[model samples]
Target: MYKYNNFYKKNFIFKIIENDIRNKKYNIICTRFPPEPNGYLHIGHIKSICLNFSIAKFYKGIFFLRIDDTNPSTENIKYIKSIKKDLIWLGFKWDKNIKYSSNYFDLIYKYAIELIKKNLAYVDELNIKDIKNYRGTLLIPGKNSPYRNRSIEENLELFKKMRLGRFPEGKVSLRAKIDMQSKVIVMRDPVLYRIKFQEHHQTGKKWCIYPTYDFSHCIADAIEGITHSLCTLEFQDNRILYDWILNNISIKHHPKQYEFSKLKIEYGITSKRNINILIKNKIVSGWDDPRLLTISGLRRKGYTASSLKDFCYRIGITKQNNIIEISSLESCIRLELNKIAPRAMAVLRPLKIIIDNFPSNKKIKLLIPNHPNNKNMGYKNIYFTKEIYIDILDFSEIEKKNYKRLILGGKVRLRYSFIIKAKKIIKNKNGNITCIHCIYYKDTLGIKIDKKKRIIKGIIHWISCSYSKPALFYLYNNLFIKKNINNIDNILSFLNKKSLLIYNGFIEKNLLQLNNNNQHFQFEREGYFFFDKKYSNKNKIIFNRIISLKKKNN
Candidate 1:
């Protein structure tokens, strides 16, 4: 095993593992990320994936990608494939071939038989509702089932019948013969196996009985020689049963279970059930709709793996659970994109500007740096023509206080070009401003003019009307308006109806020369955007806004 390093020493779980290593507990440490193939992996799973995979890599140990496909009624092959693809996209390599709980069904069933022979487990005929009543509440001790005291031979026979498709779904279940009156509710003779008539995606219809997650999880861990079984705080109580099953079983290399707080973000829905509801109602486009917090959705929205990993590391590991601000996660992507995304200018809501002083036939090629701070990124050629488009928000007929953008008879500097003074405005019959006529100072190009004398204190990005290409823009925002959705009964009521806003815009024509590599670009004074390859074609180009530019600090 590799020695514990300073980087991982801060994590409490790593500290525990380091102590085990120092005490010569085992030769090699092992970990696994076992996800149920019921839904797509979300932002919440990213933390666990990073923690489990990072710990194993840091220790030079083994890590496995196991599919916890115990309940086949909800599981599907698509979800399993999505899980593997997400892991690979996030840059994690699992050891050997992928493992499945279904692969060890025969062994787990044999272990169940061993427990029955040892008189530690018994088959229960109690219905689901009656079993719940017998389980009792946290304040009350549970009562034993009527069939709890069945003879070992009878219990074994009934269990074998259950395995042989003799029992219908929910007609019979195998429960561990643990304390029925225990204060911990899960230890009140928890069900180990239940009859599932549904065909499993992995095992098909070979067997009619299925093992519960609690029973299969620990045994699978021990069988694979997993040293640390890490899960979220919700599974902390399940640890009792995890230990009980492992301790009574005739298995070696029992792994210890540890729990940490799950990652939760404000206004973000990570629950697969709720997301499915949204999909069913057509509230979102699909699983990768970019509005959802699913890993695929984030990827479609241009969130980089490095940024996500940085977010996970910054959140760190802890026992206390809390809802993190969405801005915290947004900061990670913003910071990263600022460094790498090339600069471009786009006018979402365009207002035409005609420069009267500039030559109508002459077009100046202005070389602008792709990155403001990085000189090594070089520059791109942007055309400066007599007619151009500026964002409608950048101009006003009646300027408000502190508004520095263009105004009638007022001057503002065109970014990287010339200082232009708005002389007149053209309006339609409806009184909506359609265009602005301006005059440009030819000598102001690349020069720091006297701001006090000219009263020109604003700079706005513009694209040449003759040289730019028409494009579509998709602006995305939070799906929910409410910050704390825990108490809300109907999540749809709080849905942000205007979460996705579409706009018709123009981009630099030079961008068409670049390869279709799904590149991310920072629209000057706009935001970070990803070229939508799926929607874009030779006739129409589209860009999806990942996030808006952050407000600068004064």
Candidate 2:
């Protein structure tokens, strides 16, 4: 297991940001999570959400959830709704209605015009390829566009015409007038605006021209008076353009852009395009597929919101890019679930065990603690009977060394019940063990046993056949076959074939309490589970295995 320090302690990044704020004498601290409404939010996004919102909460300041819906081609209302749902589900509350970059279109357009009149930006007629060729490589300085010296009057008129849809798509673009010979290629006159004759999810057809993220992001942050524009480390180089725009534009606020490393897991990929391919190929169910790392997916898989928050905290904030072992995330979930998930009994691959000595047709209700360490969780009654079901994996005809479970002619303790000894085993024609005969000790029910007298080392969980409820158990494994597959083209090929497995099982009646309360239950020796909200029905109880009792594959 991986060890973690106190995540609540303010780290170097927070300390630096705090010192900078104090030096500026800023009273209100404002932070924002600006995600483009192009796809569902994934696990990586949660880190930013937690960091930004936690910082705001720590200072009792303002935190805004902003949708950067500049490109209408990919943005949609569904994505916006999903993003909001995810943030809320993660236990975060925004100050007001969510903000949209589209809302500042008019102001952003006016600012663009302001830059045009000042000769800081101009409209260019270069096609995509010509523009790329002109933007020289790292070692080479770029040549200025022939139209880069367009007069202010002509540039303003052409920009107005372009917005009016008079210019065909790709025929015109607005480029910043930053030095073409600058060392940073991103500053070599990046495109500020482009024409896209598409319907916007929010603004409809009111706009034919949309500003690029590089041009609109800082402006939106400024308009909202954001004090700290926190972004992932990938945008560390973009910080210059982020500042350049704000420096040249006339804005009321100048937010400092801070970049931190994004969250990434070794066995998982969070890119939206790759995830969408998985959905489109029907390799998985949907975005909420339990095997996926998306917030909705994790929720459907029976992970608790608190556990996810704990994971984010454990990962902490850093400027260096790193791929964390997926086990760390599983460990966090296991640790949290172990403390909170109530214990219950279940038999995934059941083998019939008949306690021939016990009274038939008699129901013995035994009270078992819901949680071993937490007495406040109270107790539930598990009905014990003559015929009960134990996991088939817990038994063996030929015992191996150090095997602690049931074997022919061996004695074992049934959890929450009696110490029983296997007397005889009935086999079918195929040599498959169909049933086992056992004798239960009458006085062994929930009592302290003398180990010398009984020599019982094997203890197993079982559910009474008479009182157990039939359930469908869905087991989830890691989705990807490889630990680290960064290339998008090869990611799908590494999809794990055994990612999901379903089994018909039996859960003790005591589990109904947890099911009814929407609580997670640890199925003794099996794993943590909860009701499958989408597939369960009156006729069939479907439970999703959140994670296993054993450590996951490293």
The candidate maximizing TM-score is 1
- Spell out the clash pairs found in candidate 1: none
Candidate 1, residue 549: the lDDT equals: 94
lDDT of 2: 0.87
In lDDT terms, which candidate is top? 1
Give the Cα-based TM-score of candidate 1 against the true structure.
0.96
Q: Tens digit of lDDT per residue, candidate 2, span 129-178?
A: 99999999998899999999989999999999999999999999999999
- TM-score for every candidate vs. truth? 0.96, 0.93
Residue pairs clashing, model 2: none
Per-residue error at 272 for model 2, in Å?
0.9
RMSD of each: 2.3, 2.9
Off by over 4 Å in 2: 1-9, 450-454, 513-515, 550-554
Backbone steric clashes in candidate 2, count: 0
TM-score attained by model 2: 0.93
Per-residue lDDT of candidate 1, residues 1-554 (tens digit): 11224437668999899999999997899999999999999998988988888899998999999999999899999999899999999998999999999999999999999999999999999999999999999998899999988999999899989988988899989999989889889999999999998998978899889999999999999999999999999999999999989998889878999999989899989888899989999999988899999999999888998888778877788899899999989999999999988888899999999999889999999988988999987788989999999999999888778887898888899999999999999999999989899999988899987767757858999999998999999999999999877546689999998999999989988775652453799999999998877767989888888988989631
The whole-model lDDT of each prediction reads: 0.90, 0.87
